[model samples]
Target: MLRYSNRSIFGIMEGATVFYTVESNNVTNLHQFNQELRNLFDRLRIRAASDGSSRKFAAGNSTGPYPATIYALMQCTPDLSKQDCDDCLVRVLGDIPITCYGKEGGSVVAPSCFLRYGISLFFEPTDDTLQSMGPPPQAVLPPESNGANATIINEKKRNASRIATIMVVAIISFLILIIYICIYLRVMRKPIGNSETTDVSSADSLQFDLGTIRVATNNFSDANKLGQGGFGAVYKGRLYNGQDVAVKRLSKNSEQGNTEFKNEVLLVAKLQHRNLVRLLGFCLEGSERILIYEFLPNKSLDYFIFDPTKRAQLDWARRYKIIVGIARGLLYLHQDSQLCIIHRDLKPSNVLLDAELNPKISDFGMASLFVLDQSQGNTRRIVGTYGYMAPEYASHGKFSVKTDVFSFGVLVLEIVSGQKNGRFQIGENTGHLLSYAWENWRKRTSSNIIDPIFKGGSTTEMLRCIHIGLLCVQENIADRPTMASAVLMLNTDSLTLPFPTRPGFFMNKFSESYKESSEFIQASANEASVTDPYPR
Candidate 1:
């Protein structure tokens, strides 16, 4: 553990400000490249402030068989002690990118630590450095045994046992010290408050610093804003490595349970599928709770499917692919994933598309988990888009895998019709998409609800999807096909579909009087996001 005393020199250097940064541009050996840098850094860390006089520190990985050699040096003012010098260098190393990221040669000279590196040896050998550095291996030595090389001395066999003992003891001591240091750092940097983010540090390797995220997101400016969601807004970002990412920043005063939302998000992160959006990592600093995801260039499904000009881009092939892709994603969540997850909010806006137009299910803020044997659960709060909620769920606060299946059904209809279910235009009557679909199905004019522009595709396949969609939205829970069955039906052309009864949201306008306030939205016949007034 590092304990900087009050009397400790928290001082900076006034001289020796110049440092020669060295690295090789032609080095193609990745293993050797990284090893050289690490070896040099490790050596520097060991010698940092260790020589009593904090004036000079030097290290290099020039002895390895690899032709590419990496050299480095860090030094502070001679007045500072070893600890102060070490702390200063440590702080510099913390910001590796600012000092040296991809450059082959660079120098970072700060008041605390002066760092320098280059491809060539820039510093001459000094008597103190040569004496302090360890002894060089003998010219004659046996070939490596299990990656270990031994030098040939007059009493090689005699000193072998002693050397082995020394190595073992050093390794053990180093490991113990590392463990102690890790525990101390974890305790020091641990999140404050009741700690909904206690387990967050377990994935610290993937965690991005708050400062780094802010820089990548351009301080969450309006230009970088993707859009607002139930809890907050999503922003597009590009990391220092040129990797694109999506940042979801939750509203500070959001009414949703911060701890519960994070727990579910962490659970969903373990889920891996081509159709499901990848959760990169999260940040919890002060009042900020942000979830990072792999950036999707094409944005959400609603972005394309809901727009007049963009809707035309979704050819029949793409639309069908989206439908099947979403089905497979749900199948993985409900059955294939490590845990059974019910996506409480599976609307078009939450389904993101990669560059290839492939669908990936995103936004699990409303998702709930269940065990393999646990099929159904209830909640006092009904949270999900209105048009997609299953009858048994919105009214009674009960939900299951079938609830998601009901939602998937609505998504299919929306994709096929290019219209939202909540407020589909129907000759100025302002009817629900599900009701218009059912009326068309009953009147033997199923094609009426389909997007007219999406013609020349397989007529039979299109009708079959509508049939499956209707089956999914059936008022009876038992009547709705499971995701497994729905996928099978979508992939199989010969599968017969039973007649679909009235979908849950059909003629649901009268139920608005029973609406409860929601964190996402309020209720109205003209529009609805998380409103389901059913109270049967």
Candidate 2:
């Protein structure tokens, strides 16, 4: 009965606001506060996961410093069953710290659930709430017996005691049997390696044999190859059913290829959204590790947006759709997916275009998952392409949801200008796209950055997007808007945008240092860029 379309269904769910911190009191002992919050989330997770999970909602408070208690309320969408609700809510609530940790009051809203916590009450305490639910009922007690009835009761009681003793013995015997069975199974299963094979058992039904894929791509002939990246080559294929698919064959020589291959196979399998590339199946036999995806005939956004001839075909209307589509897709990854994932590598080439020109995010080899309430993560082994990497992530290896915002900002500017952000020039200004956009906006000549392909499109929209892109790339991570907010800024015209300060790598001219910092990222770059492309 559901007349669902990918774009339509995606539009409906992409707007869900996942996690947010309220702008209230800033707790001084952030570490202690976070510890208490995690304890509370675990409690709720268990309560929601158990039987009688219909309520799928609970509220409680945890003690911090004296007179400083954190009051929290968590609830999942009523329609979701117990397990799904528990999973969705716990994941959504865990990102609160990254969104707003020190704040006294904040809320996270998702399509499945909404969580709010602070030093105040956001919802009325229900006596029948989930936390109050308890164990099985007892049989009604009989009225007190006396005289002749007392004698009969004593006789019955003696018999009842005998039956109860037998029942207890039988229950204990069953428990022992169950325990022995569990131990035996545990020992038998302990030898499985904690690697891709173990993690992807759930994907067994979807795995395609190498021979099947070989036939589909005719042994991965060069002519069938779509494009090559740092990790592997993608080939276009057709199954026996006549369904088109994209096959990614990773190079064995690459050091991180196996890890990335396994990660994509596991991570992409759980994510189902309109803007994401669907993983039809995977092939992992012997040394070969291949991933299959829905074939996108139009190639990638970079193939067109950076090409002069193809650029003209994407007028402002189409460009704007691409921008919005990218935003919604990022929103799904950051807030709406099964896990809080940071797509460390986000660039034009990673965005593929379908026949309808709708964008589907691709290449998840560099992505990372953030545990509940964990905002930013550090990495000594820096990854992601240059030009789009956030300053914190690129330099010190700190990345969070805001990192994606910065990349999205770079993408917006690239889409609007139909030029690569790494080497962009406007008249006398020869610097990175961010510098050019900032200078033009400040000089009241922002229109100079707009692509000539859009002659009659709305100037206001283009200007607004440029403004948003700048906000995303601000040197200060806090200044960047969350994807939910970014989507609002793009779709809702009335929302006002804050002025962006000097972005990272801001410059007046094409200095050698600037060139080094703004080098165009080739498809062959590793997980992260170690230095400027044109290092002086």
Which candidate gets the maximum TM-score versus the true structure?
1
Candidate 1: Cα lDDT at 344? 77
Kindly give the stretch of ten consecutive residues in candidate 1 with the minimal lDDT sum.
Answer: 527-536
Residue-level lDDT of model 1, residues 83-187, one tens digit each, is 667666665554443335555566655445566666676554343344434464446544664234443433465465466446634643454465457668878
Candidate 2, residue 82: the lDDT equals 62
List model 2 lDDT by residue over 180-269, tens digit each: 565477667654653223243344545677766786898999999888767678899876535789998976664545444555466667
Q: For model 2, what is the alpha-carbon lDDT of residue 173?
A: 47
Q: How far does residue 176 in candidate 2 sit from its true spot (Å)?
A: 31
| Clash pairs, model 2 backbone | 17-109, 22-106, 94-373, 383-527, 383-528, 384-527, 384-528
Scored by CA lDDT, what does every candidate get? 0.68, 0.71
Compared to the true structure, candidate 2 yields what TM-score?
Answer: 0.60
Report the Cα lDDT for residue 100, model 2.
58
- lDDT value, residue 260 of candidate 1: 55
